[model samples]
Target chain A: MKNLLTSFLLIFSLSITASAQQHDHEQHDGHQHSDHDGHDHIQEADPALKVPNAGGAHIDGDNHHQTDGHTHAGDHGAHHEPNACGIVTHHEFDPGALAFHHISDQNVYNVGPWKFPLPCILKTHGSKKIEFFSSGKFNADYHMTGTNAYNGYVLYEGIVRRVVGDFPDGLIDIGHNALGVEQEEVDGKARDVVYLCHNGNKLRCDNKSTLDGGLFGGGITSFTDFSITKNVLSMIFMVFLMSWLFLTIAKRYREREGKAPSGVQGLFEPIIVFIQDEVAKPFIGHKWEKFLPFLLTIFFFILGLNLFGQIPFLGGSNVTGSLSVTMVLAIIAFLVTNLNGNKHYWEHIFWMPGVPAWVKTILTPVEFLGVFIKPLTLMLRLFANITAGHMVMVIFVSLIFVFSKNGTSVLGGYGTSIASGLLTVFMMAIELLVAFIQAFVFTILTASYIGAAVEEHHHAEEHH
Target chain B: MGGSVAALGMGLAVIGAGIGIGMIGSRAMEAIARQPEAVGDIRANMILTAALIEGAALIAIVMAFLVA
Candidate 1:
């Protein structure tokens, strides 16, 4: 009745929203950002400059910018001369900073000269961020470029600037070690080389300003921006909505006893019971109900994330697919598992039942290592599987290009394309299954660890 | 240097898991068909074995990623 109508409306609304999102993608093949259009065509192209594929321009010697593995401004030749006062200024984009793990051929899709669009967005940008493309276009300064493949980069509010240092060598002390306010002598006068906290790009600074037109438009956007997509937002909406609906129904069910669980409640009761019986009962025994709320929440949340990732336009913004994100989730599980661990569990690890005292001393470190390893294993398993599925699919599709490049051998290209396409389809189908299994494995393992943690001899006997 | 070899190991591990799960599923189905009334008992055993297989597969995958 009431539950049925609510569910019907929910489904109806979700389908409508999904279709609307799909329509936007079909309408525009590039990034789905309505806000991007607001900051368009502000900077006229410089007539004096021609876009060159100089890889990236290393302005501060830290390779601040890169294009095709080549830096434009080679080594900052003149600027390298040490200051007369012996004070040196060093600027660098901390070496080994996280960047895209580009899996396809380096020459996939070129934007301007050096910038390449990755198949997926790996990082996020804030409101005051600016992203620079090799094409001399910033998301804040340019309109939609002719290139359509850059649909992954989401540019929010930001500004772009290109400036050069003019201070004399002896007085300009722009070193990282200088704390608080930096003092520099510029033309026999004290000046400031304000270090930009935005990305390590030499040409841009993502200024943080709460007020409109307050500072460096918020932040510098990445060349291939991929922070937000509609599917992610919708999926988030779905989870919260589902959670809210279920909680409401549970409350009502509590109020009305002896009535059959109806609609959304009916759908959820089985899953809740499954967690309680299959996960909690086996692990925690008598104290199962104590952790039921968290376990159920985690199970449903993870299940939602996995399923949402499979949506047509979601791509890999799926946080679960990200190793760092999954690592955090695994960390939470690790913390909870250890925190809930009883004294018996620690004793078992430190001093096992059958192992002699001498061996226990040696095994203590191993047992401790196992504690960290379990969650580390959880993070890697989910991250690798999801990422591998995507990478395999990408490589399979790229095979078409490989054949086409080596003398558009039509038959070979088509044959490989079709074969790879079929394999990709197969992989996608497997991915759907993997999604569920990974979520289930995570939930169950958490339960098992909890069970192991709390399993005292007395508790084990009582359960049996 | 080590990344690709480890990836290969990961692939092989997954292949082994597929085979193991396939064999388990085949046996479980055979048992269920032989005694329809004992489907519940067969399913319990099947799930337990599948979990064990998955545990091994997951551990191997994790190791491969770590080395990579």
Candidate 2:
């Protein structure tokens, strides 16, 4: 069953590559040439605009974002002139960076080009002076600059730090820095070094603001972040939706009593029954009831998140794609499995019965390590698969941008729309199935793990 | 250079997974063919084993992505 699905996934990606046939065929040369020849091509691609160190754009084997490779080869005049400072800022977005951004927390939810900044709650460490504020304080103009300040705080890398400054707009030529420390004498007077203290504590200046090269990481700006990030908000919304849906179903179950289930309960009853009968019963055997609630919660929770991920309009925050979230889920599974382990489970892990002492020495350490490795594998599996799926989907969408002559000229995008759209549809169709498959896979694996932990091996031998 | 190596790594990951899964699938088909009535049981066991292999491959792909 899964083979067909897996084979389809592979075919979908191959066709995607095949669809961009002519252009991709050119890129095949880069792939064959490897690094050195690729660099030479990039360097010689344009000469008029070249500086001593053109620093060949970090194009991957596919030559993505360099769609003008042919035209640029003929006309070096198209290259942008180096800035007056003699430096060309090459803005290259590494795919790993894209992966990181997709799975990482954000203080804002971006839908396409529109950004909706979320509310942030920051408190000074120790004193815990909690101040609730919108991330808009560091919006377009204020972000990463000195001008923006709200409640004597500025945002950097999503962390709120306290800084008291006149800023870029109201630059007061104070004789001292923002930390109020006497600066090195400028014309025999201490040079003014504006500082942003973390909590207005002069002694803790190390928690200083990051703006204008202030010591941010090691400054007196010890602040605990309590921001309402995108994933947090999404998870909260999910919890609320699940609770309401399950509660209504529960009420329906109560009202139906002796009647055949219908409506909402009808929809969920079969799936719930499937988990109980197929997964839990098969794996855990007689002890299925003990872990049913745990298994079902994770199943529904992950299913909800996965289904939500397929809808791109809703900020597309990959909650399960985050390692931290999966890691925590894995940890919960670890705790339950060990906590429910029977005496025999402990004996097998620590000192296996009937095993030779020498063998036990080797087996004990491996078994001990297995305890951590199981959860680790579970974490990595969920996070990576979800992340990979999300990446593939995003790449499908980005192909439009990549085709449009270095992400410029909307005119080129319309031409490539047909091919990209088809690929996107194919990928999305696979993802819909993946969403359910992943949830089922995760639940069944959990059930199987629990089944192993609480299993009575000796009793089984007697039965045989 | 790094990207090429990363691509190679990702390719290797996929290849290893493909072989492992192909073996499992072929064996599973044989089992199902011999006992068509037990298809459901055979399918379940096959998927479980195949998924374990996929998990390992996914981890490798992620490590390769880190390099990319």
Candidate 3:
């Protein structure tokens, strides 16, 4: 217990230092970008003055003072920067955006202050050739914003985005104050488009296409990313860890024969027995043995990923929290339940035996819809619970920055740190419980659905 | 404006779920008090029923997010 407490303190301290570094980098970057923008505005105004057009000179003078005041205000308090179009943008600490970003999968796995690059596999539209390269070539900074663009691709917030249109595309430094977001009409709907300023020209960047078909603010773009992202890496790691532990336990059981379980085997015996006795035997009935392996696989897999994500200062990869992952899990569960469904299940869904004709029509459609809705609910339940848990933890930590005013107030920072730390620890405890409950809930629900599909028609006859 | 409406929808959904889970918890407590030996079965059933109710509330919340 003493050792555990010391390690916990170590991780907490490391995370605090990492967050402080990121906050400082954001402020520093804003200052430099605004200064560069002011210089460019002055140069442009000088050219306008030389033209000797009174109206044009007056407009240019006003623009110059506006930018100067913006920069001056930025210097005294808030961090603000002028975009390429001379619009002053405020850079406040948004906890919501930060939490979302932290939970989203990325091409770079962050462990404390360090970011480890992953392999990038990208394919552009109308191109048969697939591009394979390490994300390290992009030279990503503290914020995961790459300083250099390679092969028309740039790392923005740890995700690889392709630059639109044609240009010289090897390794090129796009320079500071280049990235900006603008609202533009796409297909009659306003969308925030990301653009990069390179050599006095604005180049648009395309986000990776999503399967949601724009329902989630993502649509088909110039490229599709099939990268082994941070979430994928974490999933692979969890699979290997689980496999090793289970395999070891299996071997121990074989050697021990009839002897009582010991060591690691002792630890997992109760959980495995609980699922078998409580979940499988009661729900799956006579066919419990056939589906027990599948139930255990998903239960342990999800539980492992959940606990892995809770580890502070690690990559904290939100694998189970991701919609894509949960969707696939739900699909597999749906397939399993339907495939093993008996004749009674199909008859019950398509036509009720004793119901009136009109009632049967309504019942059939409702039952059919329920078949699909079951898995859909399973997918959303796990995804929402885990994602909300992660987001809450991040928001709790972000309270430190909010109270400290981004570290400008030393006393506030110190005082809020203690309170934020306590809140974070409390949230972590709740999240740990949620991890177990969600995994158990998912397994039991799947069992019940399977049970409904395979049950014999003897009960119906008895009712009649 | 749309965001605020979405938030309101989410809050309403939570309230419904809160009341549902509360009833389940209270009933489970009563059952446990009546029959201490069957506490395990009562607790498990309570969780399953509460999760089913939560599924409905979560669907509403997610719909509000997507629409708004």
What's chain A's TM-score in each predicted model? 0.52, 0.66, 0.86
lDDT of 1: 0.52
Which scores greater on TM-score, model 2 or model 3? 3
Task: Give the alpha carbon lDDT tens digit for every residue of A188-299 in model 3.
Answer: 5566677777776778889899875454568888899999999999999999999999999999999999999999999999999999998999888888999999999999
Task: Give per-residue CA lDDT, model 1, range A119-152, as digits (tens).
Answer: 2333323335443233212222211121121212
Regions more than 4 Å wrong, model 2: A1-100, A112-114, A123-128, A141-224, A407-412, B1-11, B59-68
The DockQ ranking, best first, is 3, 2, 1
A134: Cα error in model 1, Å: 20
Give the per-residue lDDT of model 2 (tens digit) for B1-68. 77689889989999999999999999999999999999877877887888889887876776675555
- All candidates' chain B TM-scores are 0.94, 0.95, 0.93
> Per-residue CA lDDT of candidate 2, range A240-328, in tens?
99999999999998888999998888999998998898889999988999899999999999889988877856777888877767878
Q: Which candidate would rank higher by lDDT, 1 or 2?
A: 2
Worst ten in a row by lDDT for model 1 chain A: A91-100
Q: DockQ score for model 1, please?
A: 0.17
Off by over 4 Å in 1: A1-239, A251-257, A399-425, A459-464, B1-68
Better by TM-score, candidate 2 or 1: 2
RMSD of 1: 16.2
**Cα deviation of A308, candidate 2, in Å:** 0.7
